[model samples]
Target: MPRRTLPTAEDQAARFVRQREADRKATAEDYVELIADLLREEGEARAVDLARRMGVSQATVTATVGRLQRDGLVETKPYRGLFLTAAGTALAAEAKARHDLVVRFLIAVGLDAGTAEQDAEGIEHHASDKALTAFARFLSERGDTT
Candidate 1:
């Protein structure tokens, strides 16, 4: 077997950049998904609710929500609660799908349900499309759809 060369510094830096960007995107997806859930369960997604769910302070939530608004992902209605725009809705749906797939795959591999749920929270955001496809295929082959 041929020995693989180590990644150069530039390669490492590029990978870091990509990972950071993915993390940032994941944060947005999580917020939108939570907002969608809150809307479904409570008819509204207030800043306080988001802050509580996210385990962050209201100040942090406000800052993040401001950035999301600027990115056209969400919109505020003054006294009304925050709402997702069309783009945000689409992103949330995609994120939710990924999360479900990851959680299911983890459980199928024999991980405890509770551990899988926690592990999936982070893996769902970073798993590659190829890996996700493989996980789906593995589940399908097992005749499992839970």
Candidate 2:
């Protein structure tokens, strides 16, 4: 058997760049998804509530929300509550779909529901679209519609 070749420096650098980009987007995706959930479940989304659910400080939520507003992903209506822009809503849907797919794939591979959910939180952010498609195909091949 021949020895396997290691990745080139350029390939490694590209991989690292991809990971860094994913890491940066992960927080934004998580926030938008959570806001969407809160809005659907509680009819509103507040920075305090986000902080509590995310285990972060209100100040952190405030800062992040401010950035999101500047990015045109969210809006605030004074006394009302946090609301997602059209772009944000689309993003939240995509994130949720990715997360669900990851969880299902994990479960189909033998992980428990609890562990799959916890692991999917991070895996969904890092998984590429191609990988997600492959997972979906695998599930479909196995007749897993659940």
Candidate 3:
């Protein structure tokens, strides 16, 4: 039998910090991504629509949208739907790319498309750039063009 070594306190703390940061960003990423999708598909993103799509209350959507505005990611016009600032658009594009890459990697590893998509929702948020690059290399090695 081999002896197992536990992580040091510093290592554990760093790991927790990484996870917490990811957790905090997940909601913002999801909102921006959804907003981008809605704008592309329907040409508008309203608080009511976001609430419906997110399965949250309108008040919740309003609160989060306020935070996003303060962060300079979004803007609102009187009687008009929500609009993404340049920063928000860039973030949304990046988030969507990461999500798509994760889904493709999962599928290439033999998971079904539905399962891969569901799993990628969480995995995309937590995966670092290095991890995503490795996944891309693995897919490339496997000759997966799609």
Which predicted model would earn the best lDDT?
A: 2
Angstrom error at residue 25, model 1: 0.8
lDDT of every predicted structure (CA atoms): 0.93, 0.96, 0.95
Candidate 1's C-alpha runs over 4 A off are 1-5
lDDT of 3 by residue, 1-146 (tens): 99989899999999999999999899899999999999999999999999999999999999999999999999999899999999999999999999999999999889999999999999999999999999999999999866
Compose the digit string of candidate 1's lDDT tens values, residues 1-146: 99999899999998888789889998899999999999989999999999999999999999999999999999999889999999989998999999999999999999998999899989998888899999999999999776
lDDT string for model 2 (37-72, tens) is 999999999999999999999999999999899989
| Greater-lDDT candidate between 1 and 3 | 3
Report how far residue 58 has shifted in candidate 2, in Å.
0.7
Which regions of candidate 3 fall more than 4 Å away from where they truly are?
1-3
